[model samples]
Target: MAELFARDTLSSQRWRRRLVPNQSFTLGRSTQKYPVVWDKQISSQHAQLNWNGVQLEIRKIEEAANPIFFGSRPRISFMLDPGQHFVIGHTEFLLENSEPTMPLPHRSPRTEVTIRPEEIRRTSFRKTPGRIELLTELVSKMTASTDHDQLITIALQQLLHGIPHATDVQLLEQSLDGDTKTFSPIAWDSRDGVSTPGGSSQSLIENATTSHMCVLHVWPNEPDPATADFTQIAGHDWAMCIPLEIKLNQVAALYISGKRARLEGNLTEVEILQDDIKFAELVGSTFANLSRNMALERRQSQLNQFFTPGLLDHVSTDIESYLAPREAGLMVLFCDLRGFSAATEDNIDRLIPHLHQTSETLSIITSAILAQQGVIGDFHGDAVMGFWGWPVSASENPLGGIQAAWEIVQTLAGTEFLCSDTPAKAGIGIAAGQAVAGMIGSRDQVKVTAFGPPVNLASRIEGMTKPLGIPLLLDDHAVTQLQSHPSMPPNTFLRLGSFRLSGLRQETQIFTVNSGEIAWLPEFSQALILFEEGDWPQAISILQSLPTQFGPRNLLLQYMQGFQNQCPASWSGTIERNTK
Candidate 1:
């Protein structure tokens, strides 16, 4: 029978489907047909495979998002001869001529026990000089491999090489979820060219896993054909399964089988010696530790997107201590590109370049936050939200957010990121207060973010930057915190004035920093004080006296003129904003 054998290169999973002569089959992610789940790279209708009486013909269909790779080059259509294979996404599909057979059950192990490292005496294990050299070479290969799949493949190959009589060696991942247990093939190598060697004894594997030990089973020579357990060890005489401890939920095992006839000697049922078993156990232990380290490194790489090296090191030691949700003091910062929308709209023909430009701009903001040891919360299009003091108290560096904001302004000023173009501008807002901060979301998805009035106030202050004619603003709390902190630089913090933020009841005093070109700061401060005190005449006089280049003074002059040169009766020294 003709069949299509599929293997997931990363997961070490195998799936096969019998191909009928002159019949068409679809291979992709569509539920109505042959569905390839979990891989998004494959389109719903990725390709079509047709197996005629002579050979198999595979063609890349139009719906495939990614190309079908034949070796390194992509092929739109190709004839798959016997033993030919092609790759789509992470799955490799091959055409085979052999008829698939069900795996035969294996006999129970006569002796299974957890092997103690100290119990394995050196006197009991003996190896030739050539065998020792082979083991050394295999160990070097395993140590150099960083990927789990590659490591498993190397371990299997090395095990097969070390045990010359072994017919096949397989690496299997055994996982327990709730009451169900699963055994999946990770990698396998055979003395022959077979990709997946069959006739593995389940009873032996189960015994090794249950006891977390090494199981050795030797079938009797010339055994009775009527016994049901006889067929379990049909092809091989003796087999050994060494359990590799990876984790509490997931355990792996190394299964090695050998046919006594391959030894070319008059041997009994037990040809697998203590030396061979000991070597397999050693390789299994090395694979287990390396696999665990690889998984941790991959997870740490993902976490690096949100945390700094220092914070991530702490997080790695005790995740529950930092990730648990709780109320704590922190500083939150909100940063946004000033004219992103207009810039994107104006360059609609070159939107991709503009998007790349936006990403580059956002990278600057992210780098500044991480440099200050702040955690990135979320990104909203052109805006980025970051916070400090969760997992760790912000009492040590309450001015981190402030410092980051200042750094962003200073960094953006030197580049074309904020050129003469209106859309190239940026705005930032910072606030410090107590809030519930930690991982927030469902079981499927979660994010570390702060939720409280201070968070809202920070966003409101960011919005106020445009209307107030300033590039950056901070709430009064941030200013107070910065005042107490001795780490502040020589930059001037100008008081913008008090205003009622949208959706916030209490008025928040706004302040902006003189990071650049704020000429006539004293005049602007004088005008703001007079305007807040309802001294319209003197305030207008001082505001007019200041340079028109001062945005705050110009904005104030416009506000006073709108009231016909008189303070309104309802005015309470606070500007009321209707929107954020």
Candidate 2:
């Protein structure tokens, strides 16, 4: 085995890693084997190295953006023997043939005893009034406490009251790097309520961890020469360390210490028993469980920003299987606020308040989607994109996107904003089809979103809302899905005609939810069918009978009048849009 030392001269930071004889490791900015996040110049997978017991073999990756320099010149490949060094960016790496060593045992003289969990008698603590009160208070406080530090404090205070022999209590966290171990005190207190530092024994702490049991160290009146050099704290005559079960790659322990009997201070000697150890173990177990739960909650809260509760629950069960990138059927929805540009321009003097209004309105859009168990894919300015049928197929609710769009339209109609002149209105577009959905991006950053035709079509349909004078629009596929859905109402879908959305090769048939709002929809639909069939004279007669003020009716009349009320040579009825 060999040790690889990485030192950043700029920050004076150092890290050591053990190298196995035959295994290879890569060093780069984003490589999981060895990441150098501090330096932006180092490319991903910059170099690969392998230690062969005799020497270290290094190879520069062709795709690396930076050069690996040895001595003063750049090298594409090289061999490094023991005691040689190389530099990459601002970091310097050294290869050494020395095996990592553990810290030496303490030099002080003391006696010690170790006890495994099963060796104890498992007796309960004394049922004194003070101990009973302390135990009751600890259980009540731990149940109600949400903060990690507060719970630690409550346990420590209770321990001090229950154990009369304990003079100091500490919650210690151990961090490991290679063969090195570092212990830091999280919360500590003495019987007098004032903390004194450096009363913990490193060797005893190690013993407790290695044996996964409690360790007690005490100095007898006459120490045996053979065991006199056993490690212990210098000031405290006795100490107990109990290991805690915590997160992987992390170590924690509960440490308690007190002084021995002395002639001058009249401090009586109290024998430590299984009762004290059992009580300490109980507190440690509760603390560990609570800490784990709190950590899970924090992660869930962060995940909620992107995933709905149902999706989150599925991911929680099998994250790798659910989040793996795959092709899936998706219903994509794109909702964008109307007249936002003009509204922003109108509130140039009160930009802050206008921004608040924009955020609130966007929240309404996102909430409606999430309420229907949809995933928020992305956001662009005042627009928000959401999708359904991912992780679990939308087979259960194929009309989720349409349902959410209707809710958004109903909610935003009454929302008042700082820019009162511009009404709070939004254009919604929905499309259902095949798309690649799941977590996508490099290891450094990732986004959960869907990609393919449906996403683009949804965005294009949303843009059409403004030109077609409709608040909501859906692609033909979405309407087809809703037609067979049991929850949808009959005769609610009205065709808006086919369109060649900008950049799309296939013509998309657009439709809107009628809801009987437009009284002339029946006559308008009649004209639209005739117009699409190139029967311009018949379509014009129906259009002329309808109210001219209706936005869709007027728009259709203008299109035919553009070619002198006669069907042109290219009369496909597919309106070709030049812009999105």
Candidate 3:
């Protein structure tokens, strides 16, 4: 008898039929005469297979146009040998000759073959490039590959190549909540060398939780009286489910199946089961480690968004110690876009893109600050805060804050923001003093920030820029600190006189940077001095005579004019701010 195993073209299913000697059989779409009937693609009289006393031959009929492939290559027709395989129109057939044997008058049943656990281990370990070698290779590959999909595919291919009888393999991952599950098709190699999706007979998670191996025999057409209650849901004739322990209290399953169930040597079905389970465990462990490393990388990426690169490295080493509260002398910078609120209101439809561009502009400012070894603070609405000289001292370069602020102003002025109709501009404020920096709030909701008079004062100074009509401003402390540094820019700081802010009792001497192209520093300095000395009339005359475009805006000139009109005997040069 010649056994013809026909695999379905569409579903990758296999069926068995026996061919008798000197009998002819037709294979086509007509179900009446042909034992194998595929769909419309197969012609009514597609091909004929004839079994002579010794050999089987296949011939294409008159209606068939497509040629059949013998073995792995295409051919018109060929005689089938004991193990010859051929494919016709997506369906493949394997020929195996089983010689008839006469039975004795009273024959005893054949005994089942079984092997000891140690014997199974010896057979598996005897293979070339043994289990240990295979696992080491798998570990190296998993460690080198960062992509999850690629790693899974490589592991599956290697497993199939190692096991000759395992036809299909799939990986089942348990969902985090343990309520749902998903499976990834790793690799499938059938007799035709075609890949097929693996099927399951039971819930993979349920089987995996048992933490054991199980083998089942599937009968497609007949119900087995021995195991009548359990339906064989797998596509293949036999399947083995092996649970892989990935971690403590966590398990994943590897499903292996094949169309034939035959043992070679001491490699019985149970021994093959043991070998597959061991291999699955190794692959699962490698996957577990890779998953942990990938998770750490993701967390580090999120932290990079909040901290500078230098701070991030230190934080990763010891996060709790780095976040501890401490008092330190530092320079703080506050910056806000000039017309951000108005821009957002004007282009409501494009708000998201507008905000993305705003974020990019802020990123540039952040990079400038980080270049000077500064740490980014909180971002509130359109404003961003940055600081230096804490977590580590930067007192050796006290001018770092001012230089960073200057660069931020220059960069924002030079770069064009995307999706904006008008040019974007920013106002920055700098202050250097003692501050308390640390992580605040409860464990569930905490953030790192700096607090004290300097932090509050920096915010106030940034607000003064709008009224001053300048792009950058700083308190007297920042100016004094920069002046003490030897590398301070010549004539960059200009005295803007004293002002009593709304919250503070004492007056703060505010200053502005000489960033504009026009040279009004000399005239502005002289006018500031005269105004301080109670020479309001002369100061107002000098301020009025200066070019409007090159001089201060109407705010300062109006104040001087008001002072000139009503001069009190006890009057001082101090300006008071009633509102923030």
lDDT of 3 by residue, 1-580 (tens): 5666666668634444456788888877653334345455667777888878566788878668777778677665678886777887788777766432111111111221223323334554423446677778777866766555445555665566556566766665444436654443322334444433435545433444453533333334444545432223333444445554443334555665555445657776555545655565556556655765665676567556556667665564566677787898878999888788888999899988998988898887788777777777778888888887777776744666887887886676542211123433887888878998777668587666788888888888888776666667789888887877777767667777788877988788988776544565677778877877878777777777665543243466777666654556776778878888
Q: How many clashes would you count in candidate 1?
A: 1
Deviating ranges (above 4 Å) for candidate 2: 1-121, 126-129, 157-196, 199-212, 215-240, 245-251, 255-276, 293-327, 339-367, 370-383, 413-424, 435-453, 486-491, 500-507, 517-579
**TM-score, structure 2 vs. true:** 0.60
What's the distance in Å from true for residue 73, model 3? 41
Model 3 C-alpha lDDT versus the unseen true structure? 0.64
Task: Rate residue 560 of model 1 by lDDT.
Answer: 84
Model 2, range 1-580, lDDT digits (tens) per residue?
A: 4667666768634444557897898988776546665677788789999999889899999999888999789999999998899988998888866531222355343556676765543554533446666667787877776656556766776777667767878778887677977766655656655234345777778888889888776666545556553223334567778888653325789888766633223322333434566667777767777776766676677669777887776676566567888998899999999878999999999999999999999999999999888989988898999999887789866777887888887777432221123444888899989999888888798877888899999999999877666678899998898888887788878887889999999999998887555566788888999999999999999989876445567678888888899999878988778899
Backbone clashes in model 2, listed as residue pairs: 389-394
Which model, 2 or 3, shows the larger TM-score? 2
Question: Model 2 has how many clashing residue pairs?
Answer: 1
lDDT of 1 by residue, 1-580 (tens): 6667666777644545556799898888764335566477789888888898778888889867799988678999988888888988888888877631222465454444345544542435444546667668776876776556556666776777778778778777775568877566555667653554665777777777887767777766556667645334446677888877663236777888777634434533343356677777777777787777777777677678888987876765567566878998878999998788888899999999999989998999999999998989888889999999886778645777877887887766432221123332678888889988888888788877778877888889989777765667888888888876676655557788888888888999998775555456677788888899899899999888876545667678887888998999887888878888
Error of 1 at 142 (Å): 3.1
Instruction: Give lDDT: candidate 1, residue 89.
Output: 89
TM-score of every candidate: 0.73, 0.60, 0.53
Q: In terms of lDDT, which candidate is stronger, 1 or 3? A: 1
Best by lDDT: 2
Clashes of each: 1, 1, 0
Of candidates 2 and 1, the better by TM-score: 1
